[model samples]
Target: MPALVVFDLDDTLLDHRGAERAALADVHRMHAAHLGHHGVGHVQDTYHAHNVPLWRDFGAGRITAADLKRLRSERVLHALEAHDLDPETFSRDYLARYAEHWRWADGALDAYRAVATRFPVGVLTNGFSEQQRAKFARLPEVEALAAFAVISDEVGVRKPDPRLFEHVLGLARGVLDRPALAPADVLYVGDSFHSDVEGGVGAGWRVAWLRGDDARAPEGAAVVEDWRALLDLLEIA
Candidate 1:
C-alpha cells in the first residue's frame, strides 16, 4: 500500500464547475438589465474564454491571481457588450455567489473517509491560499479529514511543477514520521491530465486518475470514473 494518499481539491473532491455554473446564474440575474439581450449562455461562454487563458497566465507566473480575476471580468464584460457595468463589481459578485454554493463531488466525502481510515490523506491543489482555504471553511468536514492542505500560492509553486510534488512528499514524510518515504510510495488522486497525471508520474508516484469518460488512463496508472471506482482501485471496497 502507498504510504500516503493525496487528493486534488477542485473538481476531484469538490464540485467546482457546478458552483461556477450556479454562480454565473447569480451574476446573470444580478445584471439582467445590462446582460439581458445577450443571454446567459453568451455571458458564460465569454467568461470561460477569458477565464481559461488568464488562469494559464497565472499558473505560468506571467500574471497574478488578482490579475486573472480582473482581466477575465473585464474581457467578459467587453465581449458581452456590457459596457456600462463595472468589472470590479462583476468580479466581486460572481465570487460571492460562487462561495454560496460550495459542495462536495458525488461520493467524495465517503471516499475520503474510507481511504483516510487506512492511510494518511493530504491535499495538493493549485490555487491561491486564501481562496482555497476558504473552501475548507465552507466544508469543515472535509477540512477535518485532511492531514494537510497545501496550496500552490502558499508554497510558490503550482501543479505540474516537480518542485511542488517534491515539497508535498517531503511534508508527508514529516506527517507520517517516516524519513525514508519515497515518491513511489505515495498515491496521487486527481482529475486533471496535464496537472495531476503528468505531474504525479513525473514525481515517480503512483496515480489513480478520476476520469469520468471513455478516455484511457495513462499506462501504469489506475483509471476511475468516480469515487466508488477509486475505492475499488485501492482494493479497499
Candidate 2:
C-alpha cells in the first residue's frame, strides 16, 4: 500500500478548464469592443496557444511565474491590437475572475475523502503561489483534505523537475509519519501525461494519469477518466 497519495490541483481535482473558459469569456465580454473584429473564441484561442507553451517553459525552469502571467495577457492583447490596455491589470483581473468561478471536478471531494482516509493525501501542483492559494481558499474542503500542498512558486521550481518531486516526497514522509518513505511508497496523480505521469515515473513514483482520453497508458502508469475510476484503481471502493 502506498504511504501517501499526491494529486495535481488543477484539471485533475478541480474543474479548472471550465473555470478558465468562463473567466476568459467574461474578460472577452468586458473588452469586446476593444477586441475589434476578433470574437471571444478567437481571443480565447490566441491566449491558449501562447499560454500552453509559456507554461511548458515554466516547468522547464526557463521562465518565472511572473513572466508567464504578464506575458500571456500582454501577448493576447497585442494579438488583439489592444495596445491601450495594461497587461498587468488585465492579468490580475482575469485571475480574480478565474478564482470566482472555482468548481471541483465531478466526484473530486468524494475521492479525496476516500483516499485520505486510507492514505495521507496531498497536492503537488505547478502554479503561482497566491493564485493557487486563492483557489484552495475557495474550496476549504480540498484544503482540509490535503495533508500538505507543494506549489511550484513556493519551492522555486515547477513540475517535471525531480527536485520538486523529491521535495514533495520529503513533505509527504513527514505528514504521513513515515520517515522511511521511499519513492515507491507514494502515488502521484495528475491530469498531464508529460508533467505528471512522466515526471512521477522519472522520479520513481507510481503515477495515475487522470482524464486521459483514448491515450495509451505509459508503462507502469494508470490512465483514468475520472476521480471514481482513480479511486477504483487505488482499490478504495
Candidate 3:
C-alpha cells in the first residue's frame, strides 16, 4: 500500500517559535513603558515558559481551550510585573503581531516538496481552523500542497488521542481514494514527543519524531534532526 504523509503544523513544518519570538518582540516594543526594564529576550523567554505548559495542560484536558487563551497572557504579564497591563488586551495585541510573521521551519518547504513529489501529503494539527488556515494563507505553497487538513478544534479531538488518529486515517482514506488504506500505510511526523511521537506510534503508524538536533530519538523510535534527515529517512530521491 502507498503511504500518506501527514505533518503537524506548529514547530514541525512551520517555524512557530520563530514567529512567536518575533511577535513578542513587537509586543515588547509596544509595551515598552511597562516592559522597559526587561529586555525583549526576557519577555520572549517568559512567554514560552508559561505558554508551552499551558498548551500542554489544554492538550491533557486539565484546562479548557478557553482557559488556555484567557490565562496565557495573564500569566506572562504577572510574571513580567506588568500589573497594569490588561491580559485580554495584551493577548489581542500579541495575536495581531503574531499574524504578521509566519514562515516555514528551516528546510521544511523543500522537504515538503520533496516528499510530496513521491507521496500524498496532508496536515493533522491541533489548533483552530481559523488560525491554522490563516497560517496557510501566509504560505500559499503549503496550502497548495496539502491534500487535506484536520484541525483538532474542527474535529473535537486532539493528538495523543486514539480517536483523533483514527479520524485522521479515515479522512486520509477518503482523500487518497484508497478505501483499503491501513494505519501502517501512514507516516505521521511532528516535533512533540508526547503528542506526535506517542500519538503516531499508538495509532500503529510509521512515526518520524522531529528532534531537530536537539536530542536523540528514544531507543527504537525513528528520529529526524531536520527535513533533510526526514528526506533520507523516507528515501525520497
**Against the true structure, whose TM-score is highest?**
1
Q: Give the TM-score of candidate 2.
A: 0.92
TM-score for each model:
0.94, 0.92, 0.94
In model 3, the number of clashes is 0
Candidate 2 to native Cα RMSD, angstroms = 1.8
Greater-TM-score candidate between 1 and 2? 1
Model 2 pairs whose backbones collide: none
Q: Residue 73 of candidate 2: its Cα lDDT?
A: 89
By TM-score, rank the candidates, best first.
1, 3, 2
Q: Tens digits of per-residue lDDT for model 2 on 69-124? A: 88898888898898987888778778878888899888888888899888878888
Instruction: Give candidate 2 regions above 4 Å deviation.
Output: 213-216
* Model 1 poorest 10 in a row by lDDT: 212-221
Better of 2 and 3 by lDDT: 3
Q: Estimate the TM-score for candidate 1.
A: 0.94
Error of 3 at 85 (Å): 1.2
